[model samples]
Target: MPDIEIRQLKKDDVAAFKAIRLEALEMEPAAYASSVEEWVSLSDDEWASRLHMPVFVAFKSGEPVGVMGLLRQKASKMKHRSTLIMVYLRDSARGQGLAESLIDAVARFAAESGVLQIELNVSSENGRAIRFYERNGFRAIGLIPAGMIQDGAEVDEVIMARRLT
Candidate 1:
């Protein structure tokens, strides 16, 4: 751990968020649902509006290297739950415990927002991510077959959840 700084991203940090997000999509095509093309096609305002959600970015030596976001359920009945999204770390930043740091930041934010549980969908082919989530106390609750299709290939998604309360 080299003094990694994890902070909640604000609207002013749109560019930083976009860069790291696009890098995530491009570097690991199968890891995320969003594509680099989709992100690049967004307008300035569209990009800014996305920062409205809780997005946390990891900074190593003043440069953003990783990101993780939380989307709290809007429905009143499901307010206690939130979906984790856009989790990624640059190849250079992996194995330095930066990913866990980002998750810890999100967990703190979610716990403060009255969220009882945090859930995420991981591609079945990404065993590394699945294991990482498991080490962080997330458990596989279910599986969705053909949850994502890319380049004419279907990838299953594993649903995992961790209770905060």
Candidate 2:
């Protein structure tokens, strides 16, 4: 594989971000809570607002390949925690250790930001992802039954977390 570059997304990256994000939602409908239909109609400003958080994008030789976001809790009491969301990689980029790099980048940022923990939700049916998270030190903290409705069916979601401090 070529050198993969991961960096914080800027406001001007709205178009690239939208393209990759839409592809993710469309290609892997079961892995995400939001559907393509829901995200497709979002205005430019709405998409740009997503970058206000600590969202990072991965590029393989100048082409966008993956994206992830870290959202810090705004409430004072929960400020030590952040949720990892919107994690996705293009089909061509999987199984190349890129995901681990992304997770490490986020964890490093979390530690620098004084966050004590990071949380994420993953579909129970995605065994590969569950194992990947576990390998990266994130353990299942809880399970939400019927947490997401996909194609008229209820799917369970596992809540996973890792302590950064």
Candidate 3:
């Protein structure tokens, strides 16, 4: 493949981001943290807001092929924590270490952004993702049964975090 460039997500990237995210939710149903229907009904404004969030996308010639985000929580007690979410890559872009690169980018961003810990919930059945997170220095904190419901089924999720402080 050609060179891939990582950049901050932009408002104009809604369609591309939506397309890849939908493909992720549909193709790998058990590997994601979201549902296809949720993405299907989201309006352009919502997607624009998403693009404005602290998220990044990997581009190959201006086409978005991967995305990741760090959604900061606002609770005073949890001010040091942010939820690591929406990690996905287009099928053709998989296996090129994009996921690891994305994770590293997020880690550096979080550390620099003053977050003490960044956490994400991975589906229990997604062993590869779990291992990848662990390999990237995230440790499993606990298991939440029925933590997330997807497509009428309740699935367990593993909450993992990597400390920046």
Highest TM-score model number: 1
Q: Which lDDT values do the candidates have, in the order given?
A: 0.92, 0.91, 0.82
- Candidate 1, residues 1-165, lDDT tens digits: the string is 666799998888888888888888899888888789989989878988999999999999888899999999999999999999999899899888889989998999999989999999999999999999999989999999999997889989999999997
Q: Of the pair 1 and 2, which is ahead by TM-score?
A: 1
Give the TM-score (vs. native) of candidate 1. 0.97
Candidate 1's C-alpha runs over 4 A off are none
TM-score of every model? 0.97, 0.96, 0.88
Writing each residue's lDDT as its tens digit, candidate 3 over 1-165 gives 468788666798788788767777788777766678778999999988877667877887777788788888888998789888888877788788887787778878888878999999999878988988898889999999998777689989999999987
Candidate that scores best on lDDT: 1
Which of the predicted structures, 2 or 3, would earn the higher lDDT when compared with the native?
Answer: 2
Q: If ranked by lDDT, best first, what sequence of candidates would result?
A: 1, 2, 3
- The C-alpha stretches of model 2 lying farther than 4 A from their native spots are none
Residue pairs with backbone overlap in model 1: none
Cα RMSD to native, each candidate? 1.0, 1.1, 2.0
